[model samples]
Target: MKNWMKIAIGLWIAAVLAVGISMPIGYIPGLGAKARIIYFHVPMSWLAVLAFFMSMWYGIMYLRKKDMKHDIKSASAAELGFAFSILATLTGSIWARFSWGSFWNWDPRETSIFVLLLIYGAYFSLRSALEVEERRATLSAVYSIVAFVTVPFFVFIMPRMMTGLHPGEGSPAPILNANGKMYMEASMRYVFYASLIGFTFLYIWLFNLRSRIGLLSYNNHTEID
Candidate 1:
């Protein structure tokens, strides 16, 4: 198999096996049905944060080096970050519908994620609107760096201050216990961690592919000029 195909297949197999194992473990007497969402939702949210931080890191590099490759990397990471954030929001919304009796309630947590979605969407729009390549990169990089300032606030601060329907805030004891440790059954933890690793690898693979494609397209267009 081609290298990319091999990587893709490996990721698929890992995802499938993880989900299969997670389902049975999630059905264990103590764990319950809601545990299933952990496999998807938690990983999506985690990966989204990871991707955005990566974008910011590359953004800094772009500014320092003024290299288009760094810009491409930053842009690719933001695109993937946006995708993961959307998935996280949808999964959270669905989980809420079943667990909280509504799809959305403008809860601080939900509202913050929605804001993140809008910010990233606007980033893409900003990219599309500009005609000059260097200008587009610089502007978007600045926007990304500024936009991520809200991430820490939204993901960490706002949730803690308000007594929302979400799990983390206003509880003496967190949903996950002290030490931030969770008590997933062995099987579920295995699969859940596997899913996390697989998803991360998939993100890296996709980001590299996207950056390469962008570079190739840029080169082709320049050749035409």
Candidate 2:
């Protein structure tokens, strides 16, 4: 990473930690003390979507060029996405336990995330089942591209279409509204947004790190061969 990027990431991390630890905000009407989880949970969910989208983009590139590098990129992004998706689900469930009175409610949002997990799980299984490098890369890239078609539906559409405990169904979103208005107080909103920005940069940094590691491993394996 560039020095500038490193500096920015450091500053972003400080901001997120500062807000997460010290931001003073009143209890939300519905969520109470559990509302603080919003800062972390929302970022995880958003990053999961972003990661999957990146995987799909790389998958498309792999299909076009048949490059193992692109395949590596797609798989790395998917792996990160799968991790974030699990964290999001866990954090959301924790919040749900306090707010909705259950850890697993089988709500539309929960169900959608479960479906997403299964889809990504299958992607990895497909990769593990294939032995030939070229065949694995090609097939996994295709699977990655096709599986991404469900991302939008599971993450955004289905939850809103049916009644659920999560926001976006004409319910009050934790922070910003559809028109970009903050429902929380100004101070809280500022901290919340700071966390969002910080987490986004954090995701970028992590993705870069993982991609570099994948590249290095690939290069080392080829040398050994």
Candidate 3:
């Protein structure tokens, strides 16, 4: 199979695993229904982190290479990151509503992720307002890199420092806490990891497609000139 086809198949398998195994695990006669959101919410948060760092990496590359393609890739990754972040927030909110008695809270993790969304929304606006390709690329690259500096602080440091309703905060152990003590059953872990891999592959596939379309459009415009 072609590379894209392989990726598509892998993603399909992952999606199937997420859907098929999530309920069984959640209904394990004791864990209760709140566990259902885990399949979607956890993967979304992981992908959001992956997407943002990928964007930052490409942004740095754009600066080093002065290649517009790198800028396009960086922007595409950022867009995807923004999307996953929103999904993570929404799903987290739903989970919180059921598990924490509120749909929204002023928790540090919540506030920080929301701030990230705003920062990236501003990024999109900044990119749109500029007409010159080189200027847009340069400005966006710089902004992406700079904004990424906040990601480590918000997603990592701040959450650790403050008390929050979120699970990972204030614990010596990682929030994910996937050690044997808190680990999902083997069968469930299979499905969960599959979902993670699937979403990650999907992100890459979409990024490549977007990058190709961007390159084609650029070429078409250049041809007309």
The best candidate in terms of lDDT: 2
Clashing pairs in 2: none
Candidate 3 regions with alpha-carbon error over 4 angstroms: 1-23, 26-31, 168-183
**lDDT by residue (tens digit), candidate 1, 66-182:** 998898888888899999999999999988888788999888778877887898889899999998989988888898899888777876677666668765444432233335766
How would you encode candidate 3's per-residue C-alpha lDDT over 1-225 as one tens digit per residue?
Answer: 268787676768667654755446533432366666666777888877788888889888988999888888888888888999999999899788877789999788788778878987989999999999989988888887888887777766776677777653444332343242544567667666777677777777777888888888888998999
* Deviation from native of the Cα of residue 83 in model 3, angstroms: 1.6
Over the stretch 1-225, how does candidate 2's per-residue lDDT look in tens digits?
788988987887787766776766685665555667767888888888788889889988988999889988888999999999999999898778878889998887789778878988998999999999889988888888888886677666776567777653466565433455557777766777787788888788888889999999999999999
C-alpha-based local distance difference test score of model 2: 0.81
Model 1 CA lDDT for position 12: 76
| Global CA lDDT computed for model 3 | 0.76
- Give candidate 3's total backbone clashes: 0
Q: Clashing pairs in model 1?
A: none
> TM-scores of all models?
0.84, 0.88, 0.84
| Candidate 2 ranges beyond 4 A from true positions | 3-11, 167-182
CA shift of 27, model 1, Å = 8.2
Best by TM-score: 2
